[model samples]
Target chain A: MSFLFARDGHLLELGIDGLLAEELSAAERAELDQHLSTCAACQARVDEARALMAQPLPALASHTAETEEIKPPDLEQEWSAANNNRLWVATGVLLAVAAALLVVVLPSGSQPEAFTARGGELSLEVYRQTAGASQLLLDGDGAAPGDTLGFRVRLSEELHFALVGADSNDAVYAIWPPQGGSAAMGPMQAPEQLAAAIQLDATPGIERILAVACDAPFQLSDEQVLSISEAGDAPQVQEGCAQELVRLDKARP
Target chain B: MPPTLDIDQLYRRYGPLVLRRIRGFFRDPAEAEDVLQEVFVRVMESSDSFRGAARPSTWLYSVTTRHCLNRLRDAKRRRELLDEHGTAMGWGASAESAQQPAQLLIKQVWRELDPELLEMAVYYEVDGMSHGQIAELTGVSRRTVGNRLAQLAERAKDIGGGAR
Candidate 1:
């Protein structure tokens, strides 16, 4: 059958891959060489492939057996610990006020139910980078101010979502949609990290990172996020939204 | 026991080829990079399977192809692919004539095609693999590969005709 896109005499992509991998037999290589001498398009692809091959590989976080294992996070214990912390208690009044504001601002019937954290429905993987080495951060792990935090998530369903970070002072910051908008994400069977990483500021308290997924497109405006953070509540979304939260303790070096 | 596989060595050697192939399917470099990382992570996770393969590059090539195809099956990703290559759908237009016709055909009908046929289309048209080569890779007979490619060509023609 004649292929709609195939050039009659041009070399194939497999040939290019094999040529670069040095897997081609001498006869195949000679034929490709002769073809490359005449076909600029194929040669251009060869050159492009060669250039891509020469690029240095970036340092990837180690997924050693021990660190790669997924452990069920103890959210109840962590929440209790956060409440016991002096910083959390100091912000109690602000939280109470923010909670009241949230109640007033959110539409009564539209509020999404709290998403039960299931094993695979939604989960967050945190990677901490310090001094050029990247390590997976477990729940309640202490991260220093200068350390860079990268995030990845595993999801069972597609949803429009945003990652927001709330510090101990009840301040909220956008983490994923760096531009402060909701982005639609496909379901990730594996943990896929976000492209950008954020450096931890010198805030000595627990910073909660929440992954908020909704059925429809949703946005967490600065004011809404601040109110939610201050209220120590999850971001309010239309019905059908689910949330996953991970905590990082920010401590002095 | 399978031989131990060194992920760093594999990445240094095969990462580029994998990325190059992935770039064919994705227009966004960042998205391609994300897939590249995922591909390597898969390699790392299934090191024993990788180590047991006849050729590391070939193994990686197959893995990358399967991963990209599976990702394309996702509705969100399919939308992204269509958006990126939507203009290519104008196969008869002189303006889009510069684009690869096989790629244009893919952009037009990939969503409608099942995974097996889509995989065959990619192998036969995008990669320019011969029936025998595809047969070798997929473990199907060359005659079956030829029949599948013919079916793919017919489907593309139908889609192209409808689009026009």
Candidate 2:
């Protein structure tokens, strides 16, 4: 909507929305109408706005189906959004809660190690801390052997993720949201604040944490997970899974 | 006795207009239809409000506009919240082009809109309402509407490619 000046130089907001909705007194409408009588540009604008307003949606029906069934809004979800933030099922909550529980028990020293990796809209940190240390895991310092490591994961909305790890032995582990079909996590941070302990005794050669984010949840096949590390000899992921990798450096034998 | 009113009949007659109006804001047909059904349902369920508000057509027009606006707000958040809460709002294949002029304009800059300006702009420019009409509809002062409209017009010029 735009405004133009009348012959008298008074400001006039053109178009139906402006002119008609103005609740003009008789004299006002007459004045504007008289200006509009000769104003071609203003007339064109009002015509265009009205024409667009009357624009139509194409008729779409599969053999004249009765007013198609509209699945009612999930009122429960709407209620939850307005009242409770306890449900962690959104891809975000799931990713956050799912990524929140990876603990690898590596060696702990005065300063634990952390590694951060960014993968196409997903960024995560893997940091090691002494057991019960108050240090945050997202500081990008890598962890040492026998140290307890936690993860701080930040994810975009509407995406579910799984945190999977594989050691040199090719044994796979579900680091957070631990396997065995466990119950869902309770009201937690949207992008989870997770802490886990990497095993000190576990075989370590670039033990990589692969966090795969997906539009929907599917079984994380062992083969679909590619190598998620910042090292040589990383296993190549062959098939599926969009992932963000966090590599942890373990002491050499 | 006056004949009873059938909600379905009204829907068939006015649903197209409402659907087009709703579709202007959406690319997805199912989303538009969902709002369409919702508009009629509000009228059906609240027949008293429907009758008391104005002529049925006028009431439905206002209701449809309000419903689409409200649903658009919800649709933005549905992505992150619906899967866990229960069945998401069921959407069907849309017959309309997702690339309507207004929809395209919105896609380019919907995020840049301040809530108040966007609301007024959608109603005025997209919905084809006048400032005074919008003031009456939204219960705000007409001056507020003009200021918002002016802000919207200025923003459009800066953004380029908007309802002129």
Candidate 3:
């Protein structure tokens, strides 16, 4: 009962290695302690393995730009759609230029530079889990690997805010409007927290996540939409709309 | 300028881990990178559903795993498309992401694993969960966790050798 032996009646080296990695906890750690107390061989194994592990792991190769920047087929479709829309706009521009005088229409009080039209405000914050409750991240900071991070969005108007994230590897993701549904809801009266949280793992990279709030639901074609209700699905990004949301950054440990 | 998505910070935090996880799951690291971008796009698409109720890792874990699996399912189509188009015109995948015959052989081996075993392997190997953690997540015993990982490794090796 005291010795941490393999089924073969010898010390389990894997268990010892796991113990050295601090992988064992609770009952396993207690059992490991008992085994270490009496087993000199196991102790030596742990010491040797621990020393070897202390040496730095091999440095990873820097990924190529193409590898980092490439995206899956669906996003390419999304990007192509956005590109097609740009072509249409270009055609419109040609027709407009053909006209002698063009009157631009602007709604009253609508700022030319703002993301929102109807006096809407948008902001994004990252919440990190520490001790017990979640703490807000500041200064475009990041979280440690394995830490739980959640995004909270504050919107002045009840609008749809699409959330998107890009990783250090240059992969762009729709962190909010996963695939099928419309944009996420913003608070009507005040700034509020999002319900889902992100768990940072040992991926050893940073993430930038943002919420783009719009006055109306951002449009995505059915063909463009990936089924978010299913796992591993992505929604198409309407490039123009996605570019218009609020943004934030998280540093990873 | 698009004010919504923060370009610089977005790449900083989630980039490495997402890329790493995607790479771990797929045969080719380049394809993993491509999937990595799609995963982020999916995150945006599901903005409405994600309200910070669950841990973001949990959601991302399944998303990454499932997305890789689904893409693998379409590997045949991808191969045919690649052959027809000769790696041009927005096929989205780079030349490096193209599926090799050996990779396809491995994928066949991967498909033969029990669904539960495959899921557990992904959680442990890619998500970096321990046997105990995987057991808790999957409602299985620690011994079963150990066994499944060994099976996954052995099968992978077996297929890798067979492909050559």
> Can you give the TM-score per candidate against the true fold?
0.51, 0.33, 0.27
Alpha-carbon deviation at A219 in model 3, angstroms? 29
The top-ranked prediction according to TM-score is 1
Q: Which ranges in model 1 have alpha carbons more than 4 Å from their true place? A: A1-7, A62-253, B88-99, B161-164
Runs in model 2 lying further than 4 Å from the true structure = A1-253, B1-6, B26-31, B45-48, B74-106, B112-116, B157-164
- Interface CA RMSD, all predictions: 11.5, 16.0, 18.4
True contacts kept of each: 0.15, 0.01, 0.00
For candidate 2, the per-residue lDDT at B124 reads 59
Per-residue error (Å), model 3, residue B101? 20
State the lDDT of candidate 3 residue by residue for B96-128, as single tens digits.
Answer: 222343244334454464445656654443333
Clash total of candidate 2? 27
Give lDDT tens digits, candidate 2, residues B10-128: 55555555564555445466655655654554454346545554334444555665555444433223333333323222111011111144444544454455444556655554444
Tens-place lDDT digits, model 3, residues A186-242: 442222334344443333233434455555677543333322212223343544343
Itemize residue pairs with steric clashes in candidate 1: none
Ranking by DockQ: 1, 3, 2
List per-candidate RMSD values in Å.
13.3, 21.1, 18.9
> For candidate 1, lDDT tens digit of each residue in A1-253?
2111223456556567778988776777787788788877778877877887888655543333223323423333333232212111101111110111110010001001011122335666555633322345544455565455655555667877787766655556666666556777756534454655556555455656677777788887656554444223565666777776655655412
Residue B162, model 2: Cα distance from true site in angstroms:
5.6
For residues A1-253, could you state the per-residue lDDT of candidate 2 as single tens digits? 1232321333232223334334344665676678668766556655654554455533433112222322221222221121111111111223221233344433222233324445544545554444222222322223344555555455544456566665433456666555511122322111234444455333333444676555555556665444322232224333333456654433221
DockQ of candidate 3?
0.05
**How far off is residue B89 in model 1, in Å?**
10
